[model samples]
Target: MVQPAQSPEPDRSPGPARSSEPARPSDVPADHVVVLFGATGDLARRKLLPGLFHLARAGLMPRRYRIVGSAPAAEALTDQEFRTHAQQAVAEFGRSRPEGPAWEAFAAGLSFGAADTGAAEPLMAAVREAETALGGTPRRLFHLAVPPVAFTSVIDLLGATGLAADGKVIVEKPFGTDLASARALNAAIHAVFDEARVFRIDHFLGKEAVDNVLALRFANGLFEPLWNRDHISHVQIDVPEHIDIQGRARFFEGTGTFRDMVVTHLFQLLGFIAMEPPVALEAGPLRDEQVKVFHSMRALDPAHVVRGQYGGYRDEQGVDPASDTETFVALRVAIDNWRWSGVPFQLRTGKALAEGRHMVTLGLREPVLRMFPLETRAAAEGRSNELVIDFDDPGSITARFLVKEPGPSMRLADGDMLFNYRTAFSAQNFLEGYEHLLLEAMRGNQSLFTRSDGVERLWEVAAPLLDAPPAVRPYAPGSWGPDGIDGLVAPYRWHLPDRRDATP
Candidate 1:
């Protein structure tokens, strides 16, 4: 039986105001060094280096900070060569290219090392040399941009070489393939670093609007009263991509849509949306609330879930002709708790769909406002009061409400109110999601990172679905997911993007 939603403890209170700007590390460690493990890898080129450059440009780089890139079999790059490489990467991937002086200062802090991270001696020796050059027992941050298989190995190496002292580790997600593996990985990490010293990255949690969910819910009284199962009919969290997997066949094969998106990104979003008000916004309190929600999630019923694969998936390179791997998934999850008991949380993500959107839409139950008359059923149906939070480029919050039409005789029309981040803040405030998260990790702020308990609970909710996956239906590319998903969220069709243009 579902339990009633728990209320906030009497003593619970909002924590310190969340930093409006990116957090700057206090007491810059003279020995601050950021080691990029997969320095020459694709993620480094596309996200890490560009994000670091943006941080430096924002004057958020610590006083003694330096970046040491490492990779086995990678050619050793001199400072200048690395700087040039970074410049190119930033040019290609950054939101905006940096100015000459800003780029130069950031580049001056760059260096490179080549070592097999699996081997303790060579990697440690390279890191030590970088530290010596900086001349301090600098706070070290090791970022693993490599594959998950290498996680334990690199962590073991870090401990064996004594680099784990006064050091922190940043691990990228899809934390583990499943619940059991996630437990093993967490145990391994705990052995090497204190829980407080480990930062797990889930870029979705760091987005500007997503980070504001707590503040929006707790900091204001306007929405809290209506934030329960009583007022919201259903919640839709949909992330659709219009492009095919761009050469990620190998990774995609090991992790389909469920593991890649549903388990990590979708669950983290659920944590924020359903958590009881935290006593404070500090890491511990915030994460505790998240864990509670995860624990409260009811086991997903196979009948309420749907899966699909875009046509031609098997034609993709590295894909098996007999592959039944799902490239798309849609789930209707019920939280077995008071506040969300009957409310179905709809989560769906797919590659090569019609629209490329990352947004959450909350369908509010129509209130008994006698002031507005529903002359027709269609009019009443169209009067859905929705709150949409779009998490993609140019993030925004949109409120759709009903208003009287200009014509006489009390006709009603749908209207929208939008708050776009780009318009509200300066262009500089539009940092890539990774930039904000990487900065927080550097500052040792775990508020935006996932906690171990929350992670395990996430897998617990997802493991059943993975262990016995639903049948995969085929859907054409450039179409909203499998047609059958429409029935899963019956009475409330997907809030799809406009069909004015087919291209992403």
Candidate 2:
């Protein structure tokens, strides 16, 4: 087993002064039934149900576990109808096809119900019947795969139906548009389920390599000693996607790149990179460390931030013709703590970029001139070493180091020591981020989930940009973000990962 960091005790102070139950163990809950709200929705069809099927196929799901899809507008689907829907989802979007034995086995646990978000009694009756059929007081898990606007109503319904008793809830991201709403949502959720029972899901946190960051830094001795500001010059967390907002105009309109990506995904990455060692790797201790890192971060400076919108974003359906909503954002934030005092952590994310690059690069300070001879000194000036942790589809880790050219004459070349997931673990198949996250939720592990305090801190750091928005620069599709973004990294440019090189 990997050992926990020998760090100081985690802060025991309450999060956001909200009422919460004692923390639970990071183990799978027993005899549970997961009720998925908005079950016929796009997310359920594309990711959640397929993830559950994958879990069942791998024998990772609990023996008595059941999945009941519910939607207010959905007609009461027969078990056959629900199983058919699940079959199509897995066949189309799953990691693998739904084979006979595994498909039938997984489909055996499928059921469906109709429950209005505003009225939960019908759902409550259905769940009671499910538990009775399961032959015990099975733990209830409600996954709200619905929109942010429906969150409170669902929570209220869960409570009214008595489904919140000994139940856990999984909430999707964009917890709220801003800090106040986030706090409000937390309060409402807390009223229904305790903090320990709430799982704030951010699928990126469940990625294999994304989780590997903690392992790479903590488990290995080679990187930990050099992880701080003294040895590292800067950190770059870049997440630029190749696709545009053609279909998601309404979502992109309200939630720009900042709220959509930075507040949740990139900030979590920053936490993993900058947090102090945790007392333990349990949910509370780990999240406490992340919350501290967030608290240590200085408010994002506007001057260090740049925003951009794709050229034809305004012409997209449902978007305002005069929309200034940013589809891309690049900003430099400083962690105001001992380990990363002077380091500038540049975070950039956008839509319709050159490639779907998702990686974090730690640029180490250049070595001293005394290490190299006079002849090769010039070539080694700006050739700083960098450690990159990629969160692409299959994931990878790479170290860029300077090496002497084969032909001698003190000539130098940059060589990479790469570790691709496929190259290292060829026998296993890669799971989607949501698949891993959903499995973890079923297993009652909150370590990969976002915490309420962490969300609040993210909003705090992003308050300036949220309050007085920056001018959204217009950039053509298939280009790196606005030209000003290039200046943020100055001597170094963003590392663009080719889609061809990305793992499927």
Candidate 3:
């Protein structure tokens, strides 16, 4: 569903604030100004600032650079504090921390604004000032990295001040808590920003490995012809979190895996892998195809979806006891499309899972019938040609295919065509996920971002599931999820790694 970002290039425009555009441009220079709405929050402090800094480190900031972060808490915000803030993100997300002159250059490019102090006015002034300084028309990108609660306020202010209509606004996940809330938010956003101008953020789609799914299917040989129910028994999309709900317990309690992962993240990935090829890779065509996938998803009532909660985890330090939240989720979904019809697309995700992972596992059913005249039990169990794409740590891809053994009598054996990310490219060749996503956003490439319809479709499938009473079960915090998860992939025998530690 997502494509990896190319490295950062330099920002070349000559307009307002710090510069008119960002200082980097791995892709084409961004045509607009990026206004970061929540400049001082944990996300801004942790992911957003660091993400932008990484782009700058990669030399991807455009020529006319302006990073105007607007937070109601922005007033009284000092330049030194902003620098210290960015410095921390720099050390965290920036692969190689910049210091001395390089650090100064990067720091100089950043500027902050406060919402509490009437600083948003200054922020707008700064933006216009920067454009005036740059001597050209500049596009604008407003990244609403604020809390969901703050999103409405930010948009309201942006619109009140005429900033919202000036350019595009990039919104983060959990667009709404459920179908009703999502509709409300969409209506609110529609009031100011047109659907075309809104780009919802789904970071999963921007990963290098995820984007490779498209290339593997469309670009590779010997795949397109065999990519269907006859070939694929089912598909698996797993996005596990190794870390516990450290600080998100409050926000997460009101939400669960269905809202957290399935609605936007996993569903988007599914759409990409299952949707019809877009008439064109441009924003509208690509998004239209994905919207169709959403419409095609067999609307799951409460009966079709299942939820499991790990008991011991709530007793852990970070979780809440009164919570009924689901740390792990496994659901069997299907797309009513000719290509994926009858094939169950199992999506499993959780926080505090066995290990950290984000992967798409494709299981291709073996030949309908084997070489033997009368099939044996092994022959009945189709050989599974699995293609595993790992997005997080231990990144690599493994494709399992059937092969004939060299020594044994004409018997079929399974072998893997492995492509390890580490062995193929130096560890240094890879970029951080946050860095890649931020760069794409600045370059005006919405291809990696989620579309509005995509977001709504995800909710359509997940809202009913969330409302359904879950099949509650508990597992250890560090365990691989519920005990019965493996059964979902029963016929194919969920092929886990052979290593003992790999089970979790």
Candidate 4:
């Protein structure tokens, strides 16, 4: 089996006491049933089941809850058989093994049902059984862990069977192939569920480090004043994965790096970085601000974009030998707004690269006046000031600046001020992306969920490139990307992945 990449474990050592309180009684979700579609799939075994187990262990789940797992008839397992499979999945993929009272209790709540395409009766029967066991008409949360192609069928099943009535639904990424498909999908979803009842999952936004961007910018006096074009030269959101497609050749062939990473993940991160402060931190205001950022974004220019395919990709199983699909992409995105007009936001993502990094870096402009001699200035200029937010597990924030060397003759050396999450917070308190997002959805907080308008706007922003994509260049595995990418961000270089500084 091809497992997903594992992030570093957080430090377990105790730190300062947590400043936040437990969720209020009202904030806790009421008794609910989570109907997990595609329950026998890889995502369910790898993330959804494990996430639910962790949430139960953390006491974040509702007191009365049940998980009704559904899959195609051919893949369905008996309830006891499904429980055994779930135990194995949790043992292998969960942060903690399933071996105690908590595991037993969680496993007892899991059951499986079978449903074929255009058929919702079996799944609805399973839901009814779960509700009967839970005693009341519990609220439902439908988690679509299926592939993008299966989204419409499952959604149509729900609407036809009255399963979507007053229930919230969570759908995964690659929402649509392009602008037209995105609009059509949005219309289909809106037909079944209202905007408020839809939760479009973008796992990147659930990371603590990503959410902290707002706190770091708005809550602090030092960063916000210099957050605009006047003080920042450029912004970089770089995500490079060392691992290739694993066994997902068919999926990768249909959806290249642009749709998989850029439209879904990077654009969301950009909204978080480039958006003006919302009136409040609530869901409506936050999403409004994000949509506004999308509104100001200039459509992607094909000339400023670079697409690349890793060598040997076409040899993978289920891949087309003549595939022109790009596994790597780099683009110079422009946000034609007041704050970020002059500053370029360079976004890049790739699979099978030299290293894997999830980071957002802001390059600070040089000082207005040069006080030092011109000869010595070159050395100082090379080490430009940078503010970086590393979103890998055990996240951190680092600010790089030039420090005066301790010598008779003045010289500058690179220095960094860093705040690491693992050292400052308890490891037990840390939540993985899926776990965090699952809990948030149950609590009815849509702050991290993508709205319909935002989705449409993102498609609009990417229209130019999708209409006429640049040719895909070939790059060797374990390399950064194509040679053509060098000119995409001229003068400014991409931030190479560095774990040494983030190490606790």
Candidate 5:
């Protein structure tokens, strides 16, 4: 049996002063044309198209907008052919099946252009056609969803052809192979478009749970006082996937789990968790705080890192038989700051694990005075008092603590107080990760996007591991990770996600 928790009264804390005046029409996003490069790729098909459709369905899209897709000339597709392909993709991958007037209106704006890096005429021609159809000179937003190797060339193409003039660009991540490349990429992008006009996408930051991290800390009075080293023993951020690389060996081989997941996703999440309170919730202030956290992070020590490769990874198509790529990585990170001086942030992510989970757990320190006796052997040894945030679909927050067991003897047992988003706010509509980010980009909000300095700082923090990466130990397909992982978090065990805690 389950009991529903009562909703608490609204907070009376004084927040940023607000103007009661209604927003002017100028606040609305201007009509724009989204030029999607690598339009035929997996990201476009699975996330971009469906995300756009969701925005359209929610009426969040501008009054008049167009989506122009561009791919290589060899994969050229006609206008109707591309529309048909997008229709199929949206139908298959969209949150809901395409139907009714919303789908029809969204489909009307779909068009395609086939062009390669060497040629820009085709892509520009498509943009012109879309502008003509829109009946105005709308703003242009270029979304580069291409491979990293093609980033500079496409950027150069955009610059040389004057397509980047007065237009914003959205770049997908694994921004660069390493620190030097990341810096070079930044230089090239800055040469073409100003930093303010660039939006570096990190879909993890767009998650509802991730966004709530700020509200959970700032909006509430219960957690702030205990957020520092004084109360928190260690922090663990774990993201493990059950499935292996689904035929993306070409990409995964070049970008292993460390670069793909650690530098990009895990570090970004860590920033949010450990960032200082911003003076304001605006883009600059918020981003400044996140960057400060990155600055405080100590460079990853190779001794504190664990790399693992799942068995049978080489059997996958396109993988090198002797590939040294890591499919699993566990690291111990330290943030040297007044607030988090002695705290250890344990981070781990892997593919082909026992189960799939995306969550962060903060282990609270043991009480100074221990007067009660524990009847259970597990409790006697010590059980972690934790605060867990689940980032899976329908996110949840849970607090694990000790409670008195009903018995003649004085004993204690672990109990959890959970708040699940789905049950607590059943009527609320949550946007998909990419959907939220795409909408924010269109609205010219760079708060959720990563900045150039932050990206470079992350690379610098991971430099040690990237330069002299540890040996990749082999692990079974369905295991948690290599046996060495346990050694990384000595004395403190990994917080294995409990399915029950996530259930509403």
Candidate 6:
């Protein structure tokens, strides 16, 4: 069934001054304190700090709240200093830094606290101080911006320290290096916080385009009619990046393309794209459906999945002369459910590739009994229709379908039409992944966040390729990908738009 296009309900026109993005429900509550566990790190500086600044600048954050940064030496970093730091990052990061005192007030709420990993004393004390200082009776939220190694200890400590009482920790991806590890990590997190308090993030879920994907299907009458196996042949998702892993040599060295990209971002999105309609758009119902997709995905044996590591793109500083790490991966998966039994989902993602971009492509099954002559069918290449969602491109949603050429010919030709969201609606000045997700968690809106079981299922499905590595294809810098990636789709024959742009 196709999702019908939905009309804005309950005064969708956003109210007030919080976000420039979309107008959220006015009733949306904003009452909570957000603590940053690692406030000095790169992730904190680039994403977390600036994101919090965005929330404050936009008024998405509450007026009565505390912003605490905890890590080693939390006492040394004062509220003013941390706020100033956040201000600078926002100036460097915010798309259009909102003018005036909004920035000032946002920064003022920012505070710094030194948190200890081994013992929760300093951390708990710091938290207590922030609570007391910020006015005392607010909900506590801990954003774990630390690396994976410190996860177990920090979560355990938070529980042992009673920091998780009204706490919520935003866990980053690659939660575990793999499936078994993911399970262990989940267990540790659950030991402290309940499943609801643990928000596993897949940034793509926060992207307007990503969420619209579901809406495009569920809320549209036109697409729902053709959403099933009968109308769709395959789906292709590509997250390509041209940047090599230089600084991330450590992370990438351990996590190849499959673990880094496909497991979290690609599969997470797939679960959303392919899941059945939930009982409601409520968080639990939606996530439950996605979990089913993760469970239904065909288990890819080493043979079914391909892992590729191109030459010359080793550690940025040349850490390893020979890195077996694969910078690229492509796999064909089938969903055995009744709705999409025979459909194929082609999933691929990579960094250090020939491109720096991402997109989701849906190729509808070809129309039957070619009414046109064989010559015409052969020329059109048998593509019934296709829809491509380009995230990094000039940012537009487009449909590739058969339209009669104007005037003469009267022949069916493929013409593309685009629905530019930015052009259609004044693009809402919304927060990026980090800020948006942080606020959602704060508001108890788990709609865009990942569930624990979803994370474990992701690892469970992708774990097979760890040992069953596929052929390592090769591609050059500024190149689309390895020589034969296109041929991999020979069975279904997906259309390559001219030369694949070195970017997604």
- Each model's Cα RMSD: 9.0, 8.9, 6.2, 4.9, 7.8, 6.5
TM-score for all models, in order of appearance = 0.90, 0.90, 0.87, 0.93, 0.92, 0.89
- What are the runs in model 5 whose C-alpha is more than 4 Å off? 1-28, 375-382
lDDT value for model 2: 0.79
Ranking by TM-score: 4, 5, 2, 1, 6, 3
lDDT of 4 at 405: 76
Sequence-dependent TM-score of model 3: 0.87
Which candidate's TM-score is highest? Answer: 4
Q: On a 0 to 1 TM-score scale, where does candidate 6 land against the true structure?
A: 0.89
Per-residue alpha-carbon lDDT of model 1 for 339-359, expressed as tens digits?
999998999999999868888
Clashing pairs in model 2? 28-443
lDDT of 6 by residue, 1-504 (tens): 111111112122343324444335562334456778778787887887767655655556654666777777644576667767666776676543634555545555566666665655656665676566556376788888888888887787788777789678888877797778988999999888888888887777777677677788889998888878888888888787777776777777777778778877888888888888888998999999999998888777776566667667663664475777888887788888998898888877766665555677788776666565433442546555678786542355678766675786556666677776556655445446676688788877898888888887777777677756766776776666666566666565544443332222
Each model's backbone clash number: 5, 1, 42, 0, 0, 23
Q: Candidate 4 lDDT, tens digit per residue, 67-87? A: 989989888888878889888
For candidate 2, write residues 1-504 as lDDT tens digits: 111111111112332211122223332346778899988888999999888775555445665666888888546676678879888988888764666555666676777777775666666666766776677567788999998888998899888878789889999988898999999999999998999999999888888898889899889999999988779998999888998976988788988889989988999988987888888888888899999999999888888899999888998999999999999999998888889998888899999998777889888887655565433432434436788888876688888777788884776766678888867764234556887787777778899899888898888888887888879998999998787887887776666444443443
Superior by lDDT: candidate 5 or candidate 6:
5
CA lDDT for candidate 1: 0.78
| Error at 68, model 4, angstroms | 0.5
Task: Pick the lDDT winner.
Answer: 4
lDDT (Cα atoms) of all candidates against the true structure? 0.78, 0.79, 0.68, 0.85, 0.84, 0.70
